[model samples]
Target: MEYKYKLAKLQYDKEKNEELIKRQRKRAGQVFPKQLEVEFWQQHLEQARHNINQYFWSGVLIYFIITVLMITGDYWIIDRNFFKHDFIHSLLGLVNGAFCLLTLFFFAHYKILRPYYAYAAMAMIFWAIVSMTWLTMTVHTEVFRHQAMMIISMIYIMGFVLTGVKPFHMLLTGLMAAVVAMIMLLTLYIPIDVMVMGRVLVGSTVVGFLISKMLCTRERMIFLVMHQARLSEKINRIHAEELLHLSQHDALTKVSNRRTFDEMLDSYFEQARHDEVPLSLLFIDVDFFKKYNDHYGHQKGDEVISAIAKSIKDSIRHMDFVARYGGEEFVVLLPETDAHGAYAVASNIFKAVERLAIPHSQSLVDSNVTISLGFTVYKGEADIFKSDFLQRADQALYRAKQLGRNQIYYHTLQVEEVL
Candidate 1:
């Protein structure tokens, strides 16, 4: 009977060892993908390029429509019944269309030649002056007088509207105002037929230009105020988001803090439960961290922690999360990862931390920095609750600490089930 009892005890030990080996093999089968950071910024850059293209094409369409209208108006110049003769009317229409097309091309093709659009607009205003002079000097019919005056007035108003569309192009506005003033002054000396009509139209155009300028100034002031308000609101929002992030994240390492880790665990528990997917959690404590702090001082200790966090970030896939659970303690969340997968991730983290090799003179485990990890993985319809999963990992961590504090451990039941 005594020999039989001793044999049974030896067989139990052998089965337990085999189960542990089987669990390790199962975990080794799962591989973690490499992490990449550049993909995030590329998405935003593409969106900005798309918006610029859209705005440029819309401006081109507006210019095209204006050019078509000027071309059609040129046909009316040939009718002698009209106020102006065919030659003068066609000249005005052609000048307007040509300038409009030139401005459009400068804006579309050579963005660097934006200043040239103002010069082209100035040329258009010069033609307006010349047209008004010819209408007063050569045209004799009373019917032509009112028509010519109306056309000059329309040209001045159109120039003012165009200035509003491109407010940065001040040269265009100044040239148009100078032309109107010159035509008004020229009427005083020329004494051509219908001098009164020329003076009245010039005076009205100046008044209209001044009113439009005033309106533009008021609109700009309002826009500035609105812009400032938006800037202030945006700054406040950014500050709020930063504050929230800081509260939930480790200041030294920029990883999720202990409170955030707990909150995330609760959230993942619910999600995994609903989706019927596996969830794994890792409890990692840096081995001999106290000795490291003692050897390097608190400042260097902070740097070591930060470096480890970066290493963990580099090793894990984007879908996995790494958080600073507490002082020298870190946690990882692996969605859709089973017990075997979790052990594989934990082992990789172990290797990553060991490779850091931050010096610690007082450490019993090693003179260089290292980590001990405990992990748990749960799958569908398991009788285990979240607390049970955490307890199992915590127990494993305690065992690793007892076993010289540089190794990883998993639950016995999980290991046996795997075996």
Candidate 2:
């Protein structure tokens, strides 16, 4: 089971990678053909930047201490007359200049936030060490030649530890530095054991590469965790929105439920009143719906209601609002519509239901299922209460049912008849 689960997870990850590649292709339009590679480097750059910003000053302080110690150790322990050499001043100047340059860049990094600074700073230090290696190889004293190799090894370890160079760049810089040191020692004909020197150089380079690889893996894992968290957050937000939508809509009819209707009515009425526009309401009821439900089953009754709701939606304008007010009843709100527009909409809804031709053997009004509609248009103002508007529309609906159903009754100044 565990093996199968692991295989499934691997497949899921592969699919995600493909999707990411497709999206990148579409968005970039051929710029990033190798999406995963580009994405990995981009993420590495960001992570490196973050790591530098967090620990850069501290790392610089440690580097300064280590460099000072190395120079002092060489002068005191390895070569008592180190400063007497003709090239000593140049060697110290080069190393000091590189250190100062890297320190200045660290201060500027806050505003710059560029990855190239890291590369450039490391390059400066790298060359300084190379120059020192040459000076040490050419020194008159033969006994201190191995000391130069030891110092070079210290430089490698210190650069990796204190500079926080990104892993890929670190590996490249370390390998190049090691290779150059070996070549320089050989070219200068320094009296040293070739076997020992090669062992030290190759061993240090291998260790540095391993350490850099580990750091890269750590950064990649961090980036993946952050990316997954962001995706999960987005997914959760989408689910929350869907739940909210489902709560406001009828599961059966797929129309706004009573809760949504009440909320929307308040909002629309307020807007219409502020804008000084007219608002209309249509209160609709299915004719003899209880009898139809009893004759057929409640399941068929549900189908009929859903069909009528759809017909009402099809007949209305986009701006109009429809809601399942209760069983066998629906309400519509038309903003900025006058009594004539409401009447026209009601007549169309009547026709839409009739066109459905759903046989209702138990319906008292007609052989087919039908509806009665009543509507009222109000000149949006503060003078009239919302309940009064609803009551007037309800009275018109009652009048339509009394006038023998399947008809429209509209109330404005007084009761008005609509076919």
Candidate 3:
């Protein structure tokens, strides 16, 4: 009976394990689909933001130019007799100028109403056409006044079309078409003949279309050039950053390379000398690395070196500098560190490497991988030149290797000036 019970328990556990595995597989499938949905929405939002910013600024600049032109032309060019005491005509010009300036101010600040700003601009343009038409009707027999009003109306309509004003674009186009037709019908009332009105209407239509096309083309070209310039500036910045990284980093371990280390050492040494402070240096070498490379293949050897480099970097202070000093060797620069402080830091590095427990069967020192470190501390009136300081650290490293390897040695320079 006990054996029978055990067999039933085993069957129940097997069924439960299979169910858990099936649920895990279903979850994995669901995760990928949800990630794709999130990514699509993120991209769409970014594109919408870019388009809104572009159109917002472009609309602001266009409105400012138009407002300035209208104010200047109204003040200087148009004759009051053409409007003929029509207060509504003068009021329309003022309204058009004010609305354009207001639209410019709102876009320069709010920016969220970019799409609707175009519609506001189109409304101002409509008022402009109405004002011009009233002026034209008041002086229908005066050829110059009649022609100027028609030209202004046609130019305003072209502005509507170029800005993609949609319903207003169609409305303005229809209004211009109707005005041209009426001018044809009313030529009998004018002093000018039918042929002259026909010529004026045709000329106005051709010129309006041409001006609109030219403005659209010029705006598109300007946008393209500006976009390219921004892209080039971004690319150049990234390239400069990459070049800086290459100059300062080791190719293999991705730590500071020898050249950067030397440069930094010189700079810190100067600062320490000026501030009357101490600076320390540690030179580290991997023990029996060549034998380890011979035992394992070169590829595994590279992995070991990379792992050791990471260990050394992890062991150092964040403010200290560590760099690859050549094959299976490294250097550390500790600013404001004395001999005792540097020794403690080097001992920590030695222990951290041992904790990695990488196999080194042919190692001359131990069964596990280990490193030897030599440190030198520089204080006021040290017995060494800058070059001698480096040499002393190298000498200590050699002595540590000679004395059995996998140990830390400390050296202090005593400088005596020869009289």
TM-score of each: 0.61, 0.65, 0.62
- RMSD vs true structure, all candidates: 20.9, 8.5, 15.6
TM-score of 2: 0.65
**Lowest-scoring 10 consecutive residues by lDDT in candidate 1?**
29-38
**Per-residue accuracy of model 3 over 191-249 as CA lDDT, tens digit each:** 44456545554455455555554444444344334444554555566567667988899
Provide the overall lDDT of each model, using Cα atoms, as 2-decimal numbers. 0.63, 0.73, 0.65
As a whole number from 0 to 100, the lDDT of residue 340 in candidate 1 is 77
Total clashes in model 1, counting residue pairs 3 or more apart in sequence or in different chains: 1
Error of 1 at 42 (Å): 27
Going through the candidates in the order shown, the clash numbers are 1, 0, 2
In the predicted model 1, the residue pairs found to clash are: 77-86
TM-score ranking, high to low: 2, 3, 1
| Tens digit of per-residue lDDT, candidate 1, span 360-410 | 777788888888887777664456687887787787777788888888877
Off by over 4 Å in 2: 1-44, 53-173, 188-200, 213-239, 315-319, 344-348, 413-419
